[model samples]
Target: MNEFLIKSGIAKGEGNWYSRLTSSLYERIVWQKLNNPLGYIALALPSLLIAYIVSKMGFAIGVVILALIIGLPLTFAAMFYLKFGISLIIVLSFFLLGVKRFVGDVQLGLLMDFLIAVMIFGLIVRQVQERDWSFANNPISKIILVWVIYNLLQGGNPSAESFLAWVYTVRSFAGIMAMYFLLVYAIRSEKDIYFLIKVWIGLTLLGTIWGYVQEHIGFLPFEMAWIMATPERYALLFQAGTFRKFSFFSDPLVYGILLAFTSLLCFVLATGPFSKPKKIFLLAAGMFMMVGMLYSGTRAAFILPVAGLLFYGILTLKKQVIIAMFFAALVLGVVANVPSSNPNIVRLQSAFNPTEDASYKVRMRNQAFIRPFIYTHPLGGGLGSVGEWGKKFSPWSPLANFPPDSGFVRIAVEGGWLGLLIYSALLYTVFHVGIKNYLLLKNPKLKVVSLGMLLVLFSLTLANYPQEAIGQYPISLLFFVAIAILNLSVKFDRKPELLHA
Candidate 1:
């Protein structure tokens, strides 16, 4: 029987066929090793160390070291495995740290650290594989490259301090690219996109609850740790020893931005293809986010949720609702403008009137003084230059004591007009891709995602005019990811599933 089978060529020989199959299996096993858990641990070790240090040693020290560590191989591994995981981790950690100097200060530093790690990883990846630099043809990247070169030229000889600062600035721009790549690559499937949205939704709700509890009950559990660690600022804010809510975010602005973004997501989910119970839950979350936004006391914070609703209404063909929203917005604006006995109204008026307001005037005066330097320098002062210049060039400037009030102005001052142009172009591309996808896709699910992302991007762009929105890791990461997802969809001609209306 064996001879007959062999002669017929049905089987070489029973043992021969078995051996070939085994050899093929063995070769595959040798060539493509199964992912080991130890590898993940090794990769995450650097980030874990940073997290540990931040938890134990406070933010300033932790952030510097964290940045250094992230530039290493281990943390790079974790970031590679998860895709946007490192960015999300650092952002969430920053949010957890809140306005307490340890947390807020560390957040930026950690972001820098993560970016350094990503750059190192990118270099290695480029070395290992032949990458298509066609993506570099992106207008936004070109603009940023020009901006960096301009900074190098204008800044004169790049000393260690200047170089490091330049590195820091360039890293921020590169980090945005890394985020974009990660999103496009990792979120190929609708399931992955949905999972990310769920994570964002949960975090939003948690942030809102934290803000609510801190505001109403004067209870800040984890957040108070950092506040207590740095009691000086707490003392300044505390009137009658009552703590104003920073929530688990760096400041009220951060909290407000988070709420605004989350509320936009909630609005999308509530109106999208979710079940009745899920929709109800999302509606409740949206309401909670609105309450949290009001408590955040960020004047520009209202722009996001309001703009989101406006966009959604317009997209859904609800013209009357859009009109109603506009009227409501006008009423709110008038109320904010009115001189009132209420302290909140007084604060609002001060914020609105930049000329008479101490804070607003200081910001304007600093900008006016910095404008000439920015124009002449062309490249920019450097990445850390804006903050450093504020301290060195204009120590008395209000911005020296405070953070940059506007993201666009911050980039323009630090990276130059080139940087600003690049950033703007990047944002414009996001909107363009998002809108294009929305128009092209017949599927309602894709349309909703596209519209939601577009709304977030638009809201963020508007918010950037008033606050430093781009530098905030969570929002920036979210913005890039959304754009990447849309771009990928367009490239591959993949259609998202339709929602049952």
Candidate 2:
């Protein structure tokens, strides 16, 4: 911590690079020593111990396999999170939290959130230490600041019966917004953008692999137990020889929606102006996610890539390609929906023919019962008024018992039409920013990224109509990360200059 030792410790003038890096003070600096094999061993020793503790034994086959699966990435993230903090948290937020009681029913979401909080807290402490107070000045930062305030104010919602529900639901809002700010703060260059995209693809590929295993191989005992814990959920998943795979996610529906959006993202990345190897990898990743999407049995999730690419075709404005894509999609749609005994296809077909779907009819009936109340309570019933959080924390509320099948419906029920309008405006503003940046920026990579982002946002918006894709674990984290990337990619000029790195 000595300033003179830090500044005069290493020389920048022409010298032997090896000697410069291996200076006495540099050797004393633990972080600098981490560049060597000795430091790697030092770090790995502790990590091995932690993994052993997590597995409850040092070298059991299951435990070893699990440790090998996650330990490398966990250690990598730990070593580099401070430097590449936003990207690390965004990736880990989805993959780690979806572990689904890996620690004997102890949820990892809170643990992940705590880690993120500590990362941000360190950033805050650094800013304070350096007397630099200029990190959160961007337009995106302001928007997120407003959102944090809005969600915090929701605790005052009169209809929120239990403080616990408010706490439970509002944390997602707060956490996602915090992630948004962290991204706005951390992404300082094109390299950071590339790093984020790389990480996104890697996480998508990993999730797809886990989803594939759940579909084809098997599930962990706790995962199956979670399904069997609820009779209705189990029945729905096991219907007619179809076992919808939830994988590491909390539910199959959420899993499908996540994969559905990632399919669009990877598909776009594949077709983008990236390298051939990356493009091929992305194409494979897209196929994995697409397959996972199909097996998820969340019929509503199918529209995401279809809708995203349709918008993408319009953006391209290529008459032939547009025409071909539209017709191809139509043909594929017809084929996928062909009257077959395949339960997956039948479930998908029901999305197109909702009237024949009993669940759809029941949802409509449920909507009729709640529409009048939403109309009257323009603001909303309150946060946590419906859904799992509602049942747990606000069971006394009428909306608590009633199921709001769609994301928009849940928002409308909780915050009323007013809340819906605000949320929609927030989402549209994001799309508008991405589009505006795409049109204005002349950079080819930026254009590809921006256009892809516009489509991704569009896809998520459409998916929200059916699945409450946002405001949930993994999905919400991924959503905000995407938003952050798109926002960061923009070429903003209103400010004279950025205040901090």
Candidate 3:
């Protein structure tokens, strides 16, 4: 039998073409087994365990023990399951629950749910696939991996405090991944994209109405009780006798971000791809989104829509609008910087001047205080080591008071300057690819979409300097999808006409 096998080429160098082919096929099967289903499962297990443990423990000592038990498995899993949807349901469930629980005192529960969703999604993706795995292959799956890797490398420690911080990072990553997957995978063609955009527009309109009610009617649904419970947090909006909008999201910031993005999408559809009726509808949606943005009172959120319009104008035949928007931006900047006797106007003015601004000074002071430790721990204070994580892990550290405000700073503090550089490079690459594709693509609609996406990234980059918006779910997922879509669109440059709506 051994001689026959050797002679057959399946054994060594012996046999015919058939034997060689069989050997090749066998090798392929083995490789596939190592790379596919089995490998995927192995990588996802640790993240699953981490998700479960963190859900129960709130990133306490239990997470450390769990990480210790499953760390190697997680490492292996990260290598294999690079694009799986292991955490979709978990995150959606958490977000839905958060929406429901926001009315009550379940902020912690909301936080836990969000974290669990993020952890599961992030780890499974990291462990399973190769680095090149992306949305064209499976936008949702690849984004999940991105989220996991981002959260995992965020800090060094595997302790409870770090774990809790990980939860937030993970949730943000997972949520956005879910949305992108739903958008790209479920929506097969342009019509589907249109339908989904309409749905989003409708949702935004409804959310605006709901927000108005919350502000005016004194009717608090069970879903929004948590916001009501946090009187201190909600008091400013409520007391101002202005509309305190929540827009089917957890907070004004989140609501404003979603509204801004959706509005930009509407603007893209209006100006680039659709029929006249569609454009009209989109215009209406854009108007509503603008209203939502204003009511949400997120000054930072204002930049996205305005920036998107500027980009759209620059790219399209809207030269007059482009010039108008440029002057408008300049005027706004000037007005926002003008010191005035009016307190509200002065406050708005100060927002444009980060140097003398109270909030800017606070951020700078925090950065100053944390610089020494960051210098010493160049590899990062260790995952979840400072700020919120530090408060949980190393409460003694002087840097604990520095909230993880900036996503860039968060990465710098956790992974050190090296990690921040990598992140920055990745972001730059996204913008670069987006701009190149936008300029090259013949499809006017896609070009607008690409531009809008680029604006999202640019806005997030700016926002991250003052706040931790980049890693948050939905936003992060959107960022990656935008990048992926732009990257995929680049392939059509030679045949731009083929990509037109």
Against the correct fold, how does model 2 do in TM-score? Answer: 0.80
lDDT of 1 by residue, 346-464 (tens): 54445555567565666777678778756775556556555653466445544444455798888777666766776677666566656766778765565666677777777778888
Comparison by lDDT, 2 against 3, better one: 2
Mark the 10 consecutive residues where model 3 has the least summed lDDT: 82-91
Using TM-score, give the best candidate's number.
Answer: 2
Q: What is the lDDT of residue 21 in candidate 1?
A: 75
lDDT of 2 by residue, 405-436 (tens): 78889988887787787777787677777777
Q: How many residue pairs clash in each candidate?
A: 7, 3, 37
TM-scores, all candidates, are 0.69, 0.80, 0.64
Clashing pairs in 2: 379-415, 380-415, 380-416
> All candidates' lDDT scores?
0.62, 0.72, 0.58
Relative to the true structure, candidate 3 reaches a TM of 0.64
**lDDT accuracy of residue 23 in candidate 3:** 68
Error of 1 at 324 (Å): 3.3
